[model samples]
Target: MMRGGSNVSDAQLQQILSDVPRIINDPKTADVLVKRAEELGQKLVTERLRMAQARDIFDELRQIESIWLREPERALRRLHLLRPKLAYRRARVRELGPLAEVLERAVAEVVSAGDAAQRHDRFRRLMEFMEAIVAYHKFYGGGD
Candidate 1:
């Protein structure tokens, strides 16, 4: 979740926003960057399915809790350790460098529109495009 109040950083937000499109356009890059992020995602789904099947055979919430719920400390430590890895991922993406200036010109045209509704629609479409990037990144590892 995004942080609330004035502490929010524009750099971070822009990074997030900037990422939306590239991720959609590339999935292999994401996979390579994220240490089997795609494989892990599939593994997660498979584990969930296995748990559901196990639930049918055994009604033991306590067992499930023991297996999954006790890992918060480990998860936190992993997050800390993974921070550098994630940073490298972001850096690698940036190394590919800036979007073509033409895209910026297109955006400027939308931004310059006098109609607020038109501007809103333009931004919304941009967001959708970005979301596709995210989805692509999350799964296919930047095929392009």
Candidate 2:
């Protein structure tokens, strides 16, 4: 009494239906499902770790913005605009070698500046370098 377009035989379908409960109760199946669940849980943990690292980077960027920009609203706005790119950068930091070098140089320049004008200029360059890092991260995947 199988319907048209059905590939399964009636006896096969009946056997499968009859085996369903036994399959569900099988210890081997339960072990496989538990292993899969553990794998998924590990993936979730790894993802959370990446997100946390990204958040920490964003926090550092916010601090830099506040120190250099001085305007709360403007700093907040800029951080909001750059948040996604920053997240991407944090996740792929290892891949962004040149960008990381640029950032380090810019930070060094900012730290070494002796006067207000020089500090401001260096900070501006640092911000630009950071933006470049995010851009690079967006286009390229992380390193090994």
Quantify all predictions' global Cα lDDT against the true fold. Answer: 0.33, 0.40
Candidate 1 colliding pairs: 23-133, 24-133, 26-142, 27-141, 27-142, 27-143, 28-141, 28-142
TM-score per candidate, chains pooled: 0.29, 0.37
Q: Please tell me which predicted candidate would have the highest TM-score against the true structure.
A: 2
Candidate 1 Cα misplacement greater than 4 A, ranges = 1-106, 142-144
Q: Give me candidate 2's TM-score against the actual structure.
A: 0.37
Residue 34 lDDT in model 2?
A: 32
**Cα-based RMSD of candidate 2:** 22.9
- Roughly what TM-score does model 1 have, to 2 decimal places? 0.29
* lDDT score for residue 115 of model 2: 64
Model 1, position 53, has a per-residue lDDT of 28
